[model samples]
Target: MSSPVSVFTPEESRAIKQSWKALTADGLLPVGLLLFERFFADVPQVRHMFSGTGIHGDENSPKENFSMETLRENDKFTKHAEGVAAKLSCLVDNLDNTPAVMNICSELGQAHKMYNVKPEYFDRLGGVLLDVLQAAMDVGLDHPTIQAWKKAYEVIAGATKPYL
Candidate 1:
């Protein structure tokens, strides 16, 4: 199906690609995890829903086990978070492939809908991510880069809006 959102402008796409590359080069996988950390920090109750498994802290610790109970209780939020992370990673990796990017965005949006993820959460996620990026880079996002990131995410969000 055709995407509901317009394709990103060439400049926006380049900016996003550069940012993703810079992030990965800096040793962060899926930069979205930074946002997830912030999101969970703000919503502590959501942490209980997440099995500590597949998530790591700065210090060494045994992996927390996953359980169906956690899934059943917070499946929507957890699944959407996981899906968004995966989709963003895929987009970064397949940067040259428009179809792949669109597919990931569509699937991400659909997953969010199934998980009942709120639209407002997307904005929060983007905001937290930008904050994380700035901190990680030790500098604020330049205007052009910020605009590109916002534009790219907006396209992703708009494409996925139908599923939500």
Candidate 2:
């Protein structure tokens, strides 16, 4: 079977690199936190997982174990998000390095699978994250930027397909 990485085009790869530069130049770490807050808000049960708690099947918890304060200015959360962004930036920088990129994608996919994250959840998270990036870049949905993000997400989704 063709790997998910096969879906990306050269142009798409370039766009991802440009977008990553834009995001980091504008402080993506904080913006990432905001994006994740909204993304997990919809999946309340997932909050604990990000908080270092293992995922539990039940979804009826009334109170979230972690608060925004726990995430804000938290070194661990900051480091984690920064690591993810860094990995993503590396993927963009080495877009032509298919082997390395594919490996990272596969690892991410497996991690998501362990978290029981669904494809739809990824879709939603992607949308929100892109929105955060767009706002951070202070650019509307320009064609090139959006296309790059689309390609990036496609690659990630493809990587995560095994887990899903």
TM-score of each: 0.62, 0.72
lDDT of each: 0.60, 0.67
Candidate 1 stretches with Cα past 4 Å from truth are: 1-6, 26-32, 43-84, 93-100
lDDT (Cα, tens digit) per residue for candidate 2, span 51-114: 4532223355333655665566567776776666666676677676677777877887787776
- Count clashes in each candidate, considering only residues at least 3 apart in sequence or on different chains: 0, 0
Model 2 ranges off by over 4 Å: 1-10, 26-28, 42-45, 53-66
Mark the 10 consecutive residues where model 2 has the least summed lDDT.
54-63
* Model 2 residue 38 CA deviation in Å: 3.3
